[model samples]
Target: MGALKFKFLFAFVLVFIVAIGSANIAEFDEVWQQRAAMAEKDAEAAYDPYPEQSRNRAVEGRNSTRRSLRGYKGACVATNPIDRCWRCRRDWARNRKRLADCVLGFGRKTTGGKYGRYYVVTDPSDNDMLNPKPGTLRHAVIQPEPLWIIFKGPMVIKLNEELIMTSHKTIDGRGAQVHITGGAGFTLQFVSNIIIHGIYIHDIQQGSGGLIRDSVDHYGFRTMSDGDGISLFGATNVWLDHLSMRNCHDGLIDAIQGSTAITISNCHFTKHNEVMLFGASDSYPKDSIMQITVAFNHFGQGLVQRMPRCRYGFVHVVNNDYTHWLMYAIGGSQHPTIISQGNRFIAPHNLFAKEVTKRDYAPMSVWKNWLWRSENDLMMNGAFFVKSGDPKRMAEFTAKDVITAKPGSYVPRLTRFSGALHCTINKPC
Candidate 1:
């Protein structure tokens, strides 16, 4: 009887152990399932196909308002001839007052606290093109003051001539719209610490009169010879956010002459030849360092020839979605340290398609421009290129050799979200 009791007890213990093991397995499965579901939701949010019609409508309304104001001055003169005579006598006085009001805000620095520490300069009449005053406001918001320039209505700045922007400014659009309707070849040069946010910048083409000679006799050629938009030369620490740029000849954003620490974020770029460019002429080797960060942007239809050229500096391109690109989306000099990672690139044909191939530009580099693609990336283009060397044998090389070795160090480890893990072997999902 005692032997029989022992056998029965052992059977009960074995069954108990099996039950506990099953429970643990079930818990592990549940946890994995929850993680998978969350990942799917996040991807869906990032790649939502819905068009932003409302945002586009808001931009259009502002553009229309600026066009109406441009022709308003002539109408005022024609409608009131008698009043015009009186206005002409006090024309200089009225002009000075109007100019001061438009540029200097009626002798007051702040706009009655409606805007933050920033100032607003929306009137085209407030052009300080010939001689930009030390503290006068222009299309840019002067910084350290944190001013907001509400283009309260749609407006344009027709550059009768060139304009010079000084340093330390922030141009915060309080949701007011602005347009640049003027000579395409006119340039706004020499600016720093500028923040151009929430504005629709488009449709200004190149003009006649071509390149204008500066006071120093250095010909200031327009970016596209006659195109109109913001161009940064020797500028640093600038932030351009929530901007919709399109239809310019050169590029939406161009950084030349070692423009460093610039951030272009949350912008929609389209309908342009070369949406973004860095490095103008490689003649000045010292001026090649253009450290730029481009993140959270959407690049859609009508984008081609986008990227920096030879001898540029560090560029961090992350968290952006590219819908369609006509040619090689990114191609340039081998010297620039480019970090292309964590982005969703969707192209109908071969992605990362390129015309030329070359060796890595520099030696002794670290995460200098490492690429790290998260498992969560919905789409991945062509196979990432690396130097022909066994990565696992890296320990044999000296530190200097390791740094100089052309082999790419980082390998993307993708974590699949669902039962579709088998489908993601060819591409990350």
Candidate 2:
């Protein structure tokens, strides 16, 4: 009888551990649900944000909005909704915190350091890992309080180790040209509300294992870094916008381990393979809660595949220009739900890679049931998307989760200023 009781207790403990593990992995489900609610409001707004650009006509699903070009005068033409939020303003430097309210899509709630004071990064050195200089970018990101981090001048920071970040921080490289290259990359591990904008992250090499300060009160030994430009592990409410990224040793951006409520927008990606990876492993079932938005970015030349390769998540690819791709543009496995809307796919001359979508590690019998839909996307040069799954399953989605297509022709106008802009102090960005 005692032996039987021991076996029952062991079974109960195993069940409890599994339950706790599942809950821990999906800790950001509330964030994901909130973004989905925001997506509904985004659909009804018809891309109208600025009062000056309010004349743009609202249309039905999959129709183009008539943009009013009358009163808009300047070199700053904010075509997309995200750009219209904060661009074309002369006092952007002073009102830098306003950008925290401009984020859209799954990362709509990411208000990185909007409430905090500004911290100017005067030094571009990463000589120390344990005790960072006060005026350095490393120190600004590690502070306990929220901070709007800006650069003093244009500089290149080749990191000595992976720049592990804390929550509620914005690396706003607007007034200056900042470059992170030739060394380790940024790591967002178990944090929230981070905005990395207007910087160039490329040529990232792996960092060796060492003791690093991740937060104001924490110092821990970190393993050798993967050479991704930005690696998000169990992070939420993150926005990556208006950055130029290329030629990383591994992926340019990778979000895994149940990271959600993220958006990658208004960026230019070139000369990279495995550009973005949303989910890490097939065995990580917790990754099913991952949700990301890829919008208004220019996927330019020298990109082979995986403009984003996804797994076990819901990805919204909207209003991006895929101008060049040597291989297939989007690939997925492990039953990810990919909604491709209002994107332009200009396929390479290679006929074998004309298809925009590629399914991996599964036969047609298995992957055919995955929800992959291409709505109002311009399939140029014989590019095609193999759509699957039941269309009626969309009825199960909430209003916020529903996306109406804006037509692919608007991609050029939406993603016109895709890369990091050279913004003058009193001029529009």
Candidate 3:
């Protein structure tokens, strides 16, 4: 009689929990539906300067015949519309800021510091952490207002500490060889509207804490940094492109603490343990608003894992070439929505790391509800992905009609200029 009573009470509690969960799901759906309607209304007039009959932004490049048939190419066959739009131009080196327009995926809306005046970096030395040289890369980043920073010559900046970037700046390294190494790397914290492009950043080590200046007028006592190649903390509308990174102590790129509207494209990442980390900690639930696009990058030799370990945000991993990885790629913990579309994942010979995705700190029963989709992805040498999420819910969430991208097989041509380009004065970039 006692056993029967216990079993009956357990069944009743389970049924009651299910009923409550159903009610919560209905409420959540209704709220998201309202949000989708608002997003549709906004997207109709969302900063599109060249809108034709189609709803796609990349249609300009895809429809042009003269731009596609530029010099030094056989038909100019490429997959990524972003690179096809700008890289084919013979005068790309002259109009370097035109790259600010060649972005796709979620972060296609970012327009980084393009309207700023040019500030040339003539000094390569990073002698003092507190007092930086006026014409150095450190000083250029901390300037007020929007500024487009360029280099005078080839430089190797061994930083004394972290190079913290101010808001509304563009570190353009085209037509010059630039490298930041042997110390802490770039840090983007509590800033906005920035672009970092065409630089080689590697061998970053952890530095001792000191009084460092972030802006032109402000200085504060900073703690020891984690030694990431490019760290973004609470920043928005950031674009990192065509950078070559390797051998960092921590992650190569980390966008944490509610960082949003960011794109990392056309970069080459290698020789790192944790390649990119999207969220910092698990308890910080505010990171749910983070939406990042990782596209057209080459994840090449000597990478261990976490091509990106996401958390709580929406991540679009599109058209990137993953040539090597020792462990599993693309990880997350707290139910981050990951859409891995048109990526080429080449699995290594390691037998234990054939899977392309890993859900950290969650079991099968719990993580099976997370929205991790693999659409039109090319898997070679036994690479595989574990997909989940309800299709109906995913359709409701990504309700905005966006442009469609090409598949992952053409990643090689799309990423032809993946690393830092060596542009001459009289030649194309």
Which portions of model 1 show Cα errors greater than 4 Å? 1-117, 125-128, 131-148, 160-163, 181-190, 207-228, 308-310, 350-429
The most accurate candidate by TM-score is 2
**lDDT score, residue 40, model 3?**
34
lDDT of each residue in 215-321, candidate 2, tens digit only = 77766655567788999877888899999999998899999877888889989999998899989888887777777879888999899999899999888898888
In order, what lDDT does every prediction score? 0.41, 0.80, 0.75
lDDT digits (tens) for residues 131-171 of candidate 3: 78899988889888888899998998888888888778889
Ranking 1 against 3 by lDDT, winner: 3
Collision count for each candidate, in order: 11, 1, 0
TM-score of the candidate numbered 1? 0.51
Among these predictions, the greatest lDDT belongs to 2
The TM-scores of all predictions, comma-separated, are: 0.51, 0.83, 0.81
Q: TM-score for model 3? A: 0.81
- What is candidate 2's local distance difference test score? 0.80
On lDDT, the stronger of 1 and 2 is 2
Model 2 alpha-carbon drift over 4 Å, by segment = 1-74, 395-398, 401-403
